[model samples]
Target: MEQWKKNLAVLWVGQFLVMAGMTMIIPFLSLYLQTDLGLSDPHETATWAGIIFAGNFVTSFLFQPLWGKLSDRYGRKMMLLRSGFGMAIVMVLMGFAQNPWHLLLLRMVNGTISGFNPASVSLISATTPKERMGFAMGTLQSGGIAGTILGPFIGGLLADAIGFRPIFYVTGLLLFLASLLAMFVVKESFDRTKAAAKPNVSIIQGFASLSRIPQLKSLFAVTFLIQFAMIGPMPLMPLYVQELHGTAVNLAFWSGLVGSAAGLSNMVSSPLLGRLSDRIGQERILLVSLIGSALLFIPQAMAGSVWQLLVLRFLQGVFLGGLIPSVNALIRKHTPDGMESRSFSFNSSTLSLGNMIGPIVGGVISGWIGIEGVFITSAVLFVLNALWVNRTLLAHRKQRQG
Candidate 1:
């Protein structure tokens, strides 16, 4: 009925499509490198797979803030179209790579052009009422989570049915269709006169200005930590699954289920927690989620069975799903008006940073302390983040009261 609601619906589909297209390659990536790219060595294939996979996040991290700042000057819907179409082209091109190097280069470029998620968040935050920010962000998160949960499962089926290269073609086609639809459907209202009146600040200056705010600065740290801790253990999940499932033939199926467990629960709970955060306060939600997530990780590290690990991970998602929506809401609450896009872009950059570094850190930690240690490491990070967030919120309360 409302314009904001319309934007949310359109962007929700767009996010789902974009995330699905991006993640669909995950299940078969190493296999593709080995089978399609003609890599003979298992070690080389694994190395190349890790490189190509991390490549996107590396470039995306560097560019997201730039895109976000530009969106503030221009508009979020425009940025969305740019990212959507650009990614569509890249996704299709990925299917055409003749070697690991070519595919790696193409993946890097995909990262450089990636801004759809940040742009969508900025668009929704700008359009939705502040009171509904949590619910809107939460619902928006569920779309991507659902896509993430289902993408690999669907990709695995398609890979078997049609093959890997064709799967990329299908994913690219779906993403392209989404972008074309958004060209007509997605809408945003901006105060151009105000935008024109606003001084033209360089990206660095714009970033500096936003990060100068104390609350925003703290929030940014929380974002980085959340992502770092949450994703750091991801690269180890398959090996961990193998360790638990030992000598099982259906390792792929179990690994896929384990990988999707958190996302499935997150998709189911993000909106509910988000709505609750809207009423109860996002800060409280963030605090409880951090602690609950930390505690959940402990059981995961100790789980003796694959099913036990899956159950713990699912429960972890129930609370951890609240963290991002609340963090995004707090960023909106603390950031100055008219700069929401840049702030969110910065948030996206931190997320990308976590994605990029988390795996590397997990690998190194796993080497030294082993897989279970990675969970302990993640739990420690979560606890530290919770403490920082709790202390920051307390100071804000005191500052307001005083």
Candidate 2:
């Protein structure tokens, strides 16, 4: 197999472990807070859990660009190892946390060091043959989504089997194993001498430079909105399930199924759609995906049963699979040489921003317009993003052709 293919295969495992480790602890966080941290008040436990959970994204959102710029200057593999090792230590310490504050601080620090995904992306984007970039991105995405889809289920079972504190230790060990795998297996041909010789651009300047590209600016919005629309409705899913199910016996199971249904299809479709994009054009795949996802969201709002919602979400995932891989491929196509990592990093920042803000905005919107309305709102956002893609990407292509 080619070196790029080898890197993708190794990093695919690394990405899966990293994402799984990160998410595996989530299912039992509240339980840990209550039992271990002794936060008996339901309100306090809930609030602490929310803050502790958001803490990672908060720091991750602020620091990703800095890491990106550093990766460009140094090397993506170094950054990848840095994040993996750093997060491993943090996850271990969380198992030893004596209070909510300890966990929160460590979670924030974990976020501060988190760059495994973007670093892997930068490395893969840098090494993969340009013609095959879409398929690579899609395949890589499937790894993360697969991890995400399975992490909670596995975590829930393990939390019951081994208890909460030990789970963190297991998560840490998994991360360490992932780092060790990458250190020995993944190969990068990054030329640090050439990277260092390039004019040093500050993170702010780098952001400004990337932002100047018309297509990139639009793509950034697409990245943000894709995450925003998908994640915004997530928190309300259980409540919506209850509304639809009306005293069903396995409400939690149905809710979990609903939540994960999209991811199941997303993991399966990303590589397929990515290959399709490479043939038809990334812009075309992106536009059709945005529109398809938007139209599907409208039906989800009207879903009469949990099963209905589950099917719609699974179909929507097919379209969701196309969005990010195409976006990443386009970002790679448009980003100037030497700034690839920084550009991908900045895009990662927008992704983290969307993750951070989506839930809050979704909750606020749900309060105003109800759960179904949140789906409509997400639909509208996707529709607007499709228009943005049409104006910026598709139209640009036509202009160049004409």
After superposing candidate 2, which stretches have Cα over 4 Å from the reference?
none
> TM-score for every candidate vs. truth?
0.96, 0.99
Global CA lDDT computed for model 1: 0.88
lDDT of 2 by residue, 1-402 (tens): 998999999888888888888788778999999999989999999999999999999999999999999999999999999999999999999999999999999999999999998999999999999889899999999999999989999999999999999988998998899899889988888899999999999999999999999999999889999999899999899999999999869988998999999999999999999998888889999999999999999999999988899999999999999999999999999999988889988999999999999999999999998999999999999999999999999999889889
Shift of residue 82 alpha carbon in model 1, Å: 0.5
Query: Candidate 1's error at 251, in angstroms?
Result: 2.3
Point out where model 1 deviates above 4 Å.
Answer: 398-402
Cα deviation at 61, candidate 2, in Å, is 0.4
CA lDDT of each prediction against the hidden true structure: 0.88, 0.93
Q: Which tens-of-lDDT digit does each residue in 265-374 have in candidate 1?
A: 99988899999988988888999999999999988888899999999998999998899989988888888988888999899999989888888898999999899999
Residue 299 CA error for candidate 1 (Å)?
A: 1.7
